[model samples]
Target chain A: MAKPDLIIIGAGPAGMAAAATAANGGLKVHLLDDQPAAGGQVYRNITRNQDRLTHLGPEYTKGIPLADALDHPNITHVAGAAVWRIDDTPTVWYSLHGKSHAIHADHVLIATGAQERPVPFAGWTLPGVMPAGAAQILMKSSDLLPKDAVLAGSGPLLYLIAVQMIEAGQPPVAMVETQTPQMMMRAVRHLPRALLDRQQIFKGLAMLRKIRAARIPRYTAAHSFKAQIQDDLLDFEFTSKGETHHLKCALVLSHQGIIPATHLTRSAGIPHKWHKAQQCWHPDHDTEGRTARPGLWVAGDSAGILGADAARAQGVITANAIICAVRGLRPSIASHVNAHAINHRNRAQAIRAFLDAAYAVPPEINTPPDDTILCRCEEITAGTIRQAIHDGATELRHLKTATRIGMGPCQGRQCDLSLTHMLAAQTQRPIATVGMPRARSPVRPVSLGEIAALEQTD
Target chain B: MMTDSRFFRRENGTYDTVCLQIDGVQTHARATDTVAAALLAFGPAPTRTTGISQSPRTPFCMMGACFDCLVTIDGRPNQQACMITVQDGMCITHQAGFRPLEEPHDG
Candidate 1:
């Protein structure tokens, strides 16, 4: 096989758009994703789940065209491929169908998308509890609904999932929201800029209205959310408005918000800084998605927490930059498509401040109480992490060594965000200074049989 | 057996149903269904037990980030059910306790 001019990881909104744009400009692009299909998490199963289009909403439908455009002759779409390593040689190594393969490219774009912030709490490891995003994936991909489900935690996605469930005729029993009144008050300052994006404002309003119309009981300013298995059924409890309430349900879906998935980027030795407003570490990159390292670029939520719309726009801009460098053209040359994508991205991102302020992941969820299990793999509790810190484990790496906090199979993907916050809070240090566990490969667990099956080739 | 009220097949869609074995019980699922979805539809039982604590765990994040959905499939232990599609006649068993490491052999 011949080496492609460009390789893009993650076939999500950003990677899909980037591949199409670059391939159209006469570059051979190889687009790879871990999913069985082209659509990423947001647009997952867009082409296959045709029976439930109305239930998925318009945001999902937009992926249909992008998935189609990925079929351009110059773009080689590789699905069900897990990329486990990238090196300074600018080489990409991945495992596919139980075999390992390597490819070289002049440029590589990391468009890996986001994952729901892990909100650890009491009974979170129970069989009935799961992230709201997980429930959304089941509904979108397999048409699985959460029977007798109760939505909990805070963020736009919580509301979005509630609305989607309602549309599908399986609304949750109630929604337990964690955003406090003070947060809403702080968000008021950004309302003027937020309203400028009339479409998003109206869409959010419509979701809220539907939830209200469906009469799904909503508890605002809820705290101390917990789930317990009693009499073989899941029982949920939380404190709202200074009153504790309890309910029995079959499923408990939770979400705090989302953070950029930085495992691959961090593992590649990219520079990252703590994003105060978003409360996560984001890779440092310029407007056109060029990273500090040459021959590499990052677009979409992996770079930061920009949504799908901005992700597509950023993908276009990044592809333009790549084309300019490869063709020896002036960087000043901005095409009409590039200008439009920039405007759209700017408009979409204008509401980020308001959204962040309104739906920040509460501190309690970030650093759960003592008994809560912080690491599911090792079964380590919050108190264990705190004790590790008290025992002179200052940084995340130190804590990992002491308590094995992130040494499980998931490889810190499930615990890294919350662990960083807990470390900062317990040690009285800034999150940036506390730092995250450095990402390593194989990023995802690849079986030894698969590795041995790899054929040695140049 | 628990009824799968959460998911229903679209009658008009042209998709085939495949039969698979879950814990020695025969179950039917759509060709497009993932192992996690098929197991969820089959019953409300936990997918597996934790390696250390032995606590029953189910699919927490069906998108592959959370490893709670790991199950033994076709004699292979610790395969992510959410990431793989269900195949006809596939045998799946709930993973329990710690999975034993492969014994080393002299080269």
Candidate 2:
């Protein structure tokens, strides 16, 4: 296969937009994703989910056009491809259909998107406790609804899932909000700028109203939330406004917002810096998504925790940048797309600050009680991590060597962010100084058989 | 246990159904359904057990991030049920604890 001019490694909002824009610019583009479809997690199953479009809302239906655009003749779309290794030579190795394949590209775009921040508390590894985003995926992909579900934690997604569930005729039993009144007050300062996006603000208010109308026992100022498995059911308990409340439910879905999934970028030897406000490490990139690496670019949530709309805008801007470089044209060539994206993205950023403040991941959720399991794969506890730190394991890599905190199949995708915060708090250091565990390839786990087969085919 | 049939069904579109075997029982599922979704529609039973605690677990993140939904399919251990789509006559087992690793032999 001939090397494509550009390779976009995720078919989500950013990736699809980048592919479409670059291909339309007369560049040969290759777009690959692990999912069987084009839409990333947010717009997953957009085509097949026509039956449940009303339940999923407009945010989902918008993905249909993006998915359709991926079918552009100049773009080669590959689905169900698990990219395991990206080398400095700018070659991407992915395993698909039980075989491995490699492709070289002049420019690579990392738009892998984000994942729900891991919130580890007591009994989080229990059968019934899960991230609220996971519940949303089930509903989006297969229309699976939790029969007796309780939504907990603090974020816009928490309420969005609750409202979606209500639309599905299976409203959650209750919602336990971890945000305090003080946080809302702090967020109020940014409301003027946030309200500029009146449609989003109104949508949020309507969801809140619907939740109230549905009478889904909403608790505010909820903290110290814990879940335990008792006789095949989840016993969820939390403190709300000085009162300890307990509820038995079949499922406990929790969320603390999302963070950029930087594993791919980090593994590719790109530089990352901690965003203090967003509370996560993002790839060090310029406004046009150009990283320090000569031929690589980072866009979408992978660069930072921007939402899908901003991701789409950033994708267009990055593609324009890539086109300028590939065609040896001046940066001034794509100035129009850059200007429009910058304006749209700045608007999104205005509201993001308020959302970040209003639904910040609680400190307690990040550094759970000592005995809480920190790493689900290794079953390592927060106490063990603390012990490792006390033993002079100052950095994440040091802690991994001492306690094996992130040496699991999931490759720290589930625990890295929480561990970074936990380490910073325990050692009284800034989160950026604490640093993240060094990323290694293959970024995703690949079977030995697949690796061996690659050699034979070569 | 109440099945997911009443809770989830295609409202307007039609898709072909395929038969698969789950834990020794024959089950019917849509071709578009993922392994996790097919098993979920059967019931809310635990899909697998934890490696260290031996506690029951289900599909937490329907995406590939969480490894909670690992199951044995077609004799391959530790396959992500959420990532793979269902196919007719495929055999799946609810994994319990860790599958002992096989010793490597000289090539």
Candidate 3:
């Protein structure tokens, strides 16, 4: 491995951009990613699948140059490197090819990217039901697609995938949207601000036009939704405007929105604030991507849900900030270098305001039906969790101890947000005040043998 | 409950294919495939049942965030199928329940 002055954990847009920019600024950087390649989730397999994935659109196909930026001697990109832990000394503890290694770096930037927010519905854990993003991922990496796919829940990603599927010549059966017409009305006020970034708006509208051109059924304000396996397809039932609708499809892909993959950030004791707009725990970081903890920086969607373009800008901005700190370069110079990136980032974040308002997660998504499952690992249901809350498991910690909600292999990534919302809502308390799961050792599951074989590198 | 894979792979790629075994059945997967992807394209739905309720499950997040795709590969227990690449001759199987804890040996 190249001796790294800066370690960027995650080879997503932010990490890849930061690694290249920092290395160009005379710092040897080590970029580690869990995926087999450097293209993170947005452009997953962009390096390898660009030729055949034309249906994925130009933005995805255009990421190869950025992915290629790591082709410098100063940057060491390690694929299949699962980072399990980190510390204040800025040492990155990760497992690569079955061996654990703890390497020290002067500055550690976490750009681990975002994950699909888990909103449990009845029978969501069933075999044929999965996240909508999962379908996109399967298409991106494996060249696989589900012809009879039904997209439920609400967000930009659902539309993106629907358009992508249509282009792939395998249109989805239907889209049962959870966002109501009222939510659309409320979001209109922010449209002007969103339209400031005309390209982003046009991109969304173009996708909508394509989706309409394909003429797939789109149901809005869907509620009481549940998925069950019927014959060889997923039997999905939902209600909209008092009208019940049923769709039997080969697969049911669900999504609400995305949240920062904050397992590592929260584990590292970084201060996080509840982003009320996004309704998720967002790691607090400055514009330059510096956390309150010095030498520990966070950029990209992992910091918040600011799309790929902003993530790239934040990555460059953060790399410049790191350059200023590490090389004793002028901070003003770093700021100067990051000027354009900062402007682009501001616009992207502004555009997000309209999205956050429109697709604001339906309140019911967090509070699933009593029969719905809460923690997938434990198979604990909403009835059980609510009972635990009623049985004096009022606090987050108590509920976890009582029902084992957040104690799973995914480490609450699947259930933590819902758990927090459920507890606060059930108890009639404020959601923000009801804290979160405590920091745990492996954010990613690793074997006991692998831990015993860990070796430290200076 | 569905044993047939609901996923269909597009055959327009110029990529090489790799052969691996899923639950002792010989399966040919694209070299660009992950264990999870291969299972989706060729193997069964409800690839594995829940450790607690024995409820059938499949890989939820094709990203590594969800452990639904956890499978045993090359004698290792509880490996994330999405996190690893599909290799030729690699043995993969549906993981049921939690793996038994192996006792630590004296160093």
Candidate 4:
């Protein structure tokens, strides 16, 4: 494989920004993603027609800059390439449409992005149960909506999705939320930071106002008790303030938080730090997004879940840092005095605060209804998990070993964060003190046949 | 309109139901189906408990990576239902509290 001066692993906001900056700066750049197009999950392009909008309402995701970035001659974007592994030698091995290929790079920027955190419970594995992210995917990829859906869980995404649903004329049956007023109030410390991005603040505030106008019944501090498929509809059992209740709906959209996409990073043995504030795993890095290992740099959500704007800033800075490192040129001090530095720093700080305020999983979230199931794969129960804890597992890792919480095929992606929060609440320690379990491959539960096929060279 | 289950088929004999218990309630599941799937089929919205206040939980991502589906099985804690295969007579439990370590811990 021909080597590139810079290899950006992802085509999301961060990756595209980094790639554009690098390529425009005269470096040979290669951008790779597993998707068929350049936009990552959040800004996914559903059709060639830019006019097409999603059930998520207005087309907030303007892909013009990204499309323009793809037109650059110095940058080669490889789509539909699922990267399986990365070596410390800074080599990326991936499968493109079932063909084995590699990209050797002088410097690498891992803008691989973040994925939605799963909060597992009973009936979660049912045919109708899916993360709010999946719903977003369906909306972006196929313009589909879960018929008679109920959007639940916590975070900005919930309200965002609710607004989208209402705008799409497919408002969910109900919106069940776990975010307490206390949590929202506590998040006020981030207000100053939210001020920097007036547009985002206005847009987010507008969405919230719209949700209120839509009169979508939102239950803060309410937990989804049980989700089961009954009568071809999604049934949600909910509990709040020591009372248990049930609601029958067609689809349930739930989200806890998002974590850095660290499977590839961890597989390469990159050291990580568990960010308790964000409640997820992050690759350890310096001011520049370079990892502990040389040439194996990481940026954006692959490092932490700092939203799109933060991701973009991190990408640009990381790319510039990588360029300077590889080309043996010192970073221009004058650039630090320009709008670039101020804008980037402000954006990063604002997003960081927003993320810190936004990702908290409500404290009372673990109180499942007596009949609610906990582990969807093993069909476990809240009673069972509590019994194990009473038996003596204090930490998430130990709980994992004692009860197999994160060892499943999805590599604990589905229930680890929620488990960590449970541990933190029980132990009365800071959430940051909780340990994040390591991720393994294949990231998804692909069949052995798929693995065998992936191993075959073209 | 499009359901992923339309393509489902049994991998082994007996239709391969993966058996489990939800909140001590006995349940059966398929090998290919997640515990959440089994619970949903049996009639519930969630399969796991919450993080801070011990609320009921459910599957957000059928895939194992989401960490939202932690449950206990056969006395072990923190198992993700999205990843594990269902087996007959698998005693599953919900994870609600600070699950203690089964053995001595170094951290």
Two-chain DockQ for each candidate model: 0.54, 0.49, 0.66, 0.08
- The per-model lDDT (C-alpha) reads 0.87, 0.85, 0.87, 0.66
Q: Which 10 successive residues of model 1 chain A have the least lDDT summed? A: A449-458
What CAPRI grade goes to candidate 3? medium
Backbone clash numbers for all candidates listed: 0, 0, 0, 94
lDDT of 4 by residue, A9-127 (tens): 88887888789878877888989887666777767653242554644555445555765676798899987676766775677777664455656786777788888765656666564
Q: Mind giving the per-residue lDDT tens digits that candidate 3 earns over A236-348?
A: 99998899988998888998999999999998888998998899997899888888887899999999998898899899999999999998988888898888889988887
lDDT of candidate 4 at residue A115, scale 0 to 100: 80
**Mind giving the per-residue lDDT tens digits that candidate 1 earns over B5-89?**
3344334356788999999999888888889988887887888998787999988888778888899888788888998999989
Q: What lDDT, from 0 to 1, does candidate 1 have?
A: 0.87
- Candidate 1 similarity to native, TM-score: 0.97
Residue A457 in candidate 2, Cα distance off native in Å: 11
- Reference-based TM-score, model 2: 0.96
Any runs in candidate 2 off by more than 4 Å, and if so which?
A455-458, B1-13, B103-107
User: Can you give the lDDT of residue A386 in candidate 4?
Assistant: 72
lDDT of each residue in A244-269, candidate 1, tens digit only: 99989888999988899888889888
Provide the lowest-lDDT 10-residue window in model 4 chain A: A449-458
Error of 2 at A89 (Å): 2.3
Q: Model 3, stretches more than 4 Å misplaced?
A: B1-4, B102-107
Count backbone clashes in candidate 3.
0
Residue-level error in angstroms, candidate 2, position A316: 0.7
Could you tell me which residue pairs clash in candidate 3?
Answer: none
Q: Model 1, residue A322: displacement in angstroms?
A: 0.9
